[model samples]
Target: MILLLLILTLLSLSRGRPNSSIVNHSTQLLRRLGVKRVPFQFDPYKEGLYYTNLDQNLRQVILNARNWTQISTLSNIDFIRAHNVELGRMQQTIPASSRFPCNLSQTRSPDVASHISRLRPGDIDIVAAFGDSTIAGTGIMALGFWDLMVEYRGFAYTGDGIESWRTVLTLPNILKLYNPNLYGYAVAHSLSADVKRSRLNVAEPMLYLLDLPFQVHVLIDRLHKDPKVNIHVGPNDICSELCYWHDLEAFLRLEERQLYASFRLLRDNVPRLLINFIIQPDIDDVMNVFSEMPDDCTTKASFFCNCHGKYKQEKYYNVAKRFFDMQKSIASLPELQRDDFAIVTHEIFKNVSNLWSRNGALDKRFMANDCIHYSQLAHAVLAKLLWNNMLNQTDFTLSEARRRPFEYFLCPNADRQFLRTTGDRF
Candidate 1:
């Protein structure tokens, strides 16, 4: 059975298209293997049962070269209905009475920051993101296995501009409320990163930490060539698993050198830039949630982190801690901190696994259909957390934060006065 699964993975990696027979056979094998089905309560639109092997299903479908054809036939109405259902769920979670309206009249600071350190959320002109499939938004909206190949880029927490914060609630969308003319966010979904529609979201699915410099290069090239307005590029890299951690120091050193070089190039060329380095959730923390799941679904952790299943608990914990420390060390590099460019690291996701589970049962809605990436709802929550972090507000424990209504993070009455008085700085 393991050999057959390996064969399927290799076949999916091949460039040649697999026939329908192969796809059907793979699907049957997956079902026979008793893939666990996660329960979701709010499926008003009646999307199929969510499965742990959705990513595997997606791989098979992509190998068949039929993802686009299938998506093309899917109606825009389907997207709309799915969106509406999400909105309905959000409304239930966060009632309107709990929300406080922001004074849109007083948006940006009176003057732009001479140094990136003082840059406010309202001052950002362009929004960008880099990382792996999580940042690429692979399978964010997949209702079933077949829908997994779609890159719902616009719903990504780092750089999405599908609609307003009222609906989609992404970081870019929230920033748009402050700067209406904010450019460079992925406006809608795209099949691939190379497409023009991907815009400033240069993230690619399955990219490793080593691949970040290349993505930085692509983003820089795009900024230089595009005739769009110049100045102020706020690029966020939502980093995930660093690597296998076979040689942790070596991996960190290589990544640091490459990333420093890339940032230095951007700083020298670009006038005003803010680089946000969001620390990913601890792998052990995330894997713990899966560990509690049925045996069939527990293997999903291996898909995201190769070391999780193989390593001892003590070794995994030590490696994970060292990885996070290295990330902070890289962020603190004196050379990378400049007047025009600054790197800010957010540590909110360090304990995010606590947010997804309550009393030992996982909340399936916060996760994507693949059971790997975040769902649209989770992306919205992340956007709020990132925004709160930017404001220098008290960091809410993910579990505590989940209990509060979304509006709790929005415009507070106390903030309104501060926002009104301090139009010059935030």
Candidate 2:
């Protein structure tokens, strides 16, 4: 019987058919392995589409299109919207509920010492930061902007943090040396990017730098305790900038399901977590609405994805609201924020925008050509956020701030340099 089943499964699989034999084999594999599903098939729903089939649209939209209407109303065959945004009432500012993050800062203060101190001295620690490219550190560029990299907390958003392929990214993640003033080694960090991007800058390397510190903390903690624990995940989640193109309903259902599942998995396993949710931080994100949507799409509020990416990103931010709610649900016990949890997000992006605005920063190492990601300033922002968190928890005192590792710099003067009309020469 098993032999017959195996033969039939091979026959079906070979024919590229979704027949009973193939389904049964996959089903059997799932059952035998005691797993609900496997993601080997890009579209787990067997929807007959995959990422390999979804690349061209990105270029057409980013490189060719002149406006939002051209990009949003795609023609011809279908492609999935990787994200969804609701085109609701356009306000001048983001709703207050959507602006400030939950009062985690207030609630967790009392329990920090108690919870952090209770953890086993040497138990490994893990911190995970997930989201789009801002999470990936694709900041400032050398060809156009230099000092621009000093925005997204510095290097925290650029490379994949892996030491492998060097793709000469838009935001070149090179070390700016003070001793030599410019003699740092060419860091052979990994993660290659293709030049075919709409521009020279590779897309944001999300899920990379954001996960490192916590992972390192966990690794070091385990080195002193146990040598076999890993921490933090990368920016490989199925997030994208063009998700606004999908039919709002379908886009949202898929997004909610995926996010819900992702959060649920973390909730189930890791009680102590740090998250850096990266939705666009623009004044426009709050004020814009796209009423020119399809007639049947009556749920304008639910599918808020319109392309006012700058100064307005309402469609982009609504997603953040949901992520936080999910956190509140999972950490319902109330004490998780003290020792085992935290979240860092892009607040006041407009403030950081001009700092590295056009990506032609004075700091050549900043801004990836992709108009996102980071160099140094980006890393600085991340470190600052975490550093401030530790401060809030009293994990480290003011005097000990020097011992805490993270490079922070807010360049108010970089505006002139970033917007320099002069030729590019960092």
Regions of candidate 1 where Cα sits further than 4 Å from its true position: 1-70, 73-100, 192-195, 231-249, 294-296, 313-317, 403-405, 410-426
RMSD of 1: 13.0
TM-score of 2: 0.37
Assess the local accuracy of residue 115 in candidate 2 as a C-alpha lDDT between 0 and 100: 34
lDDT of 2 by residue, 29-114 (tens): 33442334323535423321122223322323332222232223323102211111111101122333542211212221223233
Minimum summed lDDT over a 10-residue window in model 1 is located at: 1-10
lDDT of 1 by residue, 1-426 (tens): 000000000022122344555445434543643434454444332222225445554765554464443345245637744673664323233345543246555556687656554455567777767676777777777666666656777777777688666667777777777677888787767643333566777776666554454555556656776678464111111123333345555555665565565556556766556666676555566557666555534555445445555435565466655655666677667877766656666665655666666677666667666666667777787777766656654355546665433645755233432211111222
Which one is best on lDDT? 1
TM for every model, in the order presented, reads 0.72, 0.37
RMSD of each: 13.0, 18.6
